[model samples]
Target: MRASLSIVSLLAGAVAAAPAPKIPFVTATDVIPAPAVNARQSASQACFVIGSETLPKEVSDVAAALASSVTCDKSATTIANVPDVTSGSTTFSSIDFSQSSQTALQFALSKFATANPLADTDLQTFQDMLDVYQATEAGIRSVGGSLAIKVPKFFLEMQVSRIQTAQGNPPTAAGLQVDHLRDKVLKNAPRESKDLLDQVTQLATVLS
Candidate 1:
């Protein structure tokens, strides 16, 4: 009985002393590639400007009317609703631009250009806003373009959040990308963009 008790105690000690199984360290690459991370960061900043400030209030109102003009299935519920990110679907056909919508969008773009002049100013905010606006205009002119314009998913996400916020609805997944972009911008983005980091960071708090 004594020997058996000693053997049992030794086994228990051995079990306790055994090393815990190693948990695989997940590298940043395992979750998101460096290029993708940079892209998302860029998209968030650009979309924040486009949705929150760049596009005139009338442009968004026009977009809402254009969305109403389209025929969409039950899944096409709201402007805030976007396609599944993991599905690898880039374009959403839920909102097709009518001729009227196209005309309105073009007019809005023209207005944006005329209103926001890039004078000799060192403010990075204005410069970044201009860059995003030009890119959006190019997207609008692309073949089979929609009023929303094709941009990175992160940008679309921020845009949707802005729309929802305007409608008094809570932003869906608001801080997910905004917070990530906030971190990356603070750490990696150029000094010029970083100077305008408050605009993006403020979204994280408001949207959250």
Candidate 2:
């Protein structure tokens, strides 16, 4: 009976000592829908029009002119009077600004890229934009909430290195702006989003 008791004790001790199973970390890609990803891509491309060198000077000038005409009126139901551009075969006429910010940005990029082959700088910019978006999206999705403000904050934090590499200039001003915006937005976020933001912040700490 003593021997059996000793064996049982050892088995119990072993079971007690076993480590708990680790929960898997959710990545940014895990949460971002395919449409969001595409939208971001499009937005990145659209932003390229502003500074692309591959296009003719006249075309770039026209793009610059048209950009000023596109107002950022979020309260409005639609973006009014978006310009169009025709590239080799694709023609992008108008983009609905009421869509996700990324989607709106994509409309801009598509219009810009339509006539202009993307320069090396433009490609780098797109990649930088994508990296930040993915990282932020992953953080937001991993924790599961509305913490969208965290996305921009995380992007600004993570994008500095990429922007420096791609543009030869740090995004210090832009980062600060995003940080400030995040702070302001966080104050208005719902309880669930705030909670998710905390989780994402923790993940960011680990990632950093």
Candidate 3:
């Protein structure tokens, strides 16, 4: 629950500062080494800060979509609708279930936010973007080629934040599982994901 709380609040925060990164274009000639799962994730995150400078359109569109969706969903303001960021696609049993954890989550976030608000914001967006990027990457991993993902700049920042933060302690066992999920995205992303990546690159190129 503490983990999920971090996931949701972090994402929400990241969403608040999105779509500012520029896009870039380059030929997919360099077959960069598949990043160590954590390294790949870290690079994914750095892209966010990179995005703000790059301001890719693909990222902005996603941020707008997510922000709009939240605006339209009345229940979203409540923790229940936010979903258990730690759980798999399921809502929590009750606000009580969430409230039990909310205090802790907020505490941790607040503490981190107090010391590193910018990093926290970046971490949130990166994790949020994973759901989309993973679905895309999973498909391409088997195909043998570079894949692209047009992640929101905010989302990218969040991933980079997490990766950067993880560097200090190297993450716990649970954190390892989270890394696996991210690895799934890089290993399995498909054409659509590749397209998104290409889009990001193009946007970056144009913006640059």
Best by TM-score: 2
**TM-score-better candidate, 1 vs 3:** 1
How do the predictions measure up, each by TM-score?
Answer: 0.22, 0.24, 0.21
Q: lDDT per residue, candidate 2, 1-208, as tens digits?
A: 9999999999999999999999989886786545433332333244323221243332333334333332322232211222233232222222222344553223322322211211133434443333323222322232342434343333333333333434445346653343443443344334434454464233223211
Candidate 2 root-mean-square deviation in Å: 23.8
Question: How displaced is residue 131 in candidate 3, in Å?
Answer: 2.4
Show the lowest summed lDDT stretch of 10 residues, model 2.
111-120
Clashes (candidate 2)? 8
Q: Scored by Cα lDDT, where does model 2 land?
A: 0.36
Q: Per-residue CA lDDT of candidate 3, range 1-208, in tens? A: 9999999999999998797777876768956677454323332232111121222344333333333122112233222122222112322222122244333222222222212332334444344444333322222232332333222212233344355544443344453333443443334334334554343333222210
How many pairs of residues collide in each model?
0, 8, 38
* RMSD (CA, angstroms), candidate 3: 32.4
lDDT of candidates 1 onward, in order: 0.36, 0.36, 0.33
TM-score of 1: 0.22
Which parts of model 2 are misplaced by more than 4 Å?
Answer: 1-169, 174-178, 199-208
Candidate 3: count the clashes: 38
